[model samples]
Target: MTNIDVKDINTLTLSILEGADSYYRWIFQEIKPYLQGGILEVGCGMGHLTNWLLGEGKVLVADINKSYLQMVERRFKNHSNWMGGIVWDIQEDPPEDFPLSVHTIVCINVLEHIRDDLSILKRFYKLLPLRGRLICLVPALRWLYNPLDKGLGHFRRYSKKELCEKLTLTHFRILTLRYFNLFGAVGWFLQGTVLRKRLLSSVQVNWFNRLVSLFISIESRIPSCFGQSLIAVGEKS
Candidate 1:
């Protein structure tokens, strides 16, 4: 593992894992189809998304925090598909050091932290082979940016247009790009914007998780014009 300054963990990301099983599971299912070959998951904090990707393929989990990587490595120690964890700073690290087996890169809820997201996207592009996929999920709606986003060290939230443009600029073919979790958007607005809460309590997460199935059912049929997050899959062609 590469040595670097370990920053404070993303409290917002860790808090969501408290009781949001169904919520994360839904996200996993949505992105699972795009996963192929060996996968390198960027910003794999505490292994929330990594847990789901365990059996999907060979998973090389990478994060800036050494502690988080150690935890993930310990948690999945027995799993054959676990390809070990690395301490990586995407903005600073050269892509040439990544294992050649990596064909799909899954980055969930991580891009917002970087001010130079375009540079990181180009780095991700260089880390892959032909037809390699970049499965990315990010907070959507600039209007929804609030104290909670700031607390999480997020530089900016993203619009579909903004994300698509960045991915395209990196020379990736846009494969899947759309909005996700309308219900999450509503709750986020109430807590972050209306109530001025910087974090979602475990009680709130549990309540919302219980209804995740219903939310998924409804969102699947409705036109996803807007959402709490944007999910995009780009392919290196």
Candidate 2:
């Protein structure tokens, strides 16, 4: 079983701190409707979104990193709906005790790290029951690939067509497929592609966080064809 360690914790923590609450809230709103019954969240990094998901339903937060799992366990130890954390590697066969009948599987910014993403999608299909949902988010646009993507150990960014095709090939019926954060596309291009920076400045991130509400308002009115990330919802058939 191959496991990935994108171990830039300091940068990750900074990003979470600088990120706007509205951004995560918007994402939660988008995926909330599909999150019924038992849920599993893959790559529950630093419990940023995991904290929010806990309020929605019974959620099993999983990550390959033991430290993250331990942190999540400690953070939500008192909550009844917090199903505890598990060490899960998406590239390998799930543990025998892994819950296969979960109604929803949520994966965010994780698929790009796996070289064999389609195989992982098939595994996700098997883990879910018939008509179960898979909610995923990944960086979008091949042209945006740069030093930052490489530094993050990303295999590749994805387009809407590519994501939908992969999900469809793995026996998933596409429900929602769209681009997100149109404003982010410009910043990613400038920093990652043009400037070729591998890390984001905390100051800049803080500045952007302050104006995130405005960005969300403006981008929400625009079409989803232009953005820095793709968000997809699929149902097992």
Candidate 3:
């Protein structure tokens, strides 16, 4: 594993994980169809998403934090399809032994941390085979860039157009690009922009999780152009 500075964003995620199983399940459902053949999940934080991806196919669960990688390895050690864990720093070149040529790559809520996001996209392009898919999710709306984002080491929030432009520049054919979690935008603005809190309140997360199914139903029916985050599916050309 290459040496890279790992940001301490675990605290920011743990609260959400405490009550957000349904939310994560929804996300998994959205991206499930694209997860086929060999799958490489970048920034497999705490293995919340990794737990779902493990049964999909052969999976390489990776993260910049060695402790997280170890945790994932221990969690999935007995699974036949598990390819183990690696300390992967997206900003750096993948090691020679790294399985860059995978059918699908899942990178969720991670691109914002890298200063050179386009370069990272380009790297993803190189790592995938022709017509391979890259499913990514990142915080949306630059106007929502706040103290929480700064504290979490986010370089910038992304607009749908901005994310598409980056994918195009990296020679990826856009498959799906849209806003997600429309209702959560309000909570994000309240906590991150208005109140300028560095972490989400456990109470807020619990409430959100309780009502997530209803929010998902409403968001599915509406034509929404803005939300708390953007989800994009791009295919290598």
Candidate lDDT (C-alpha), each: 0.86, 0.82, 0.84
Q: 11-86 in candidate 2: lDDT tens per residue?
A: 4743555365666777787788878778899998777788788898888888888887787788888887788788
Order by TM-score, highest first: 1, 3, 2
Q: Candidate 2: what lDDT?
A: 0.82
Question: Measured by TM-score, how close is model 3 to the native structure?
Answer: 0.93
**lDDT of model 3 at residue 149?**
79
Q: What is the lDDT of residue 82 in candidate 1?
A: 88
TM-score against truth, every candidate:
0.93, 0.91, 0.93
Which segments of model 1 are wrong by more than 4 Å?
Answer: 1-9, 12-16
**Every model: Cα RMSD to truth:** 4.2, 3.6, 3.9
Deviation from native of the Cα of residue 4 in model 3, angstroms: 20
Clashes of 2: 0
Predicted structure 1: lDDT: 0.86
What residue pairs are clashing in model 3? none
Candidate 2 residue 101 C-alpha distance from true site, Å: 4.5
Position 113, candidate 3: lDDT: 85
Q: Give me the candidate number with maximum TM-score.
A: 1
Task: List the candidate 2 regions with Cα displacement exceeding 4 Å.
Answer: 1-6, 9-19, 99-101
Arrange candidates by lDDT, descending.
1, 3, 2
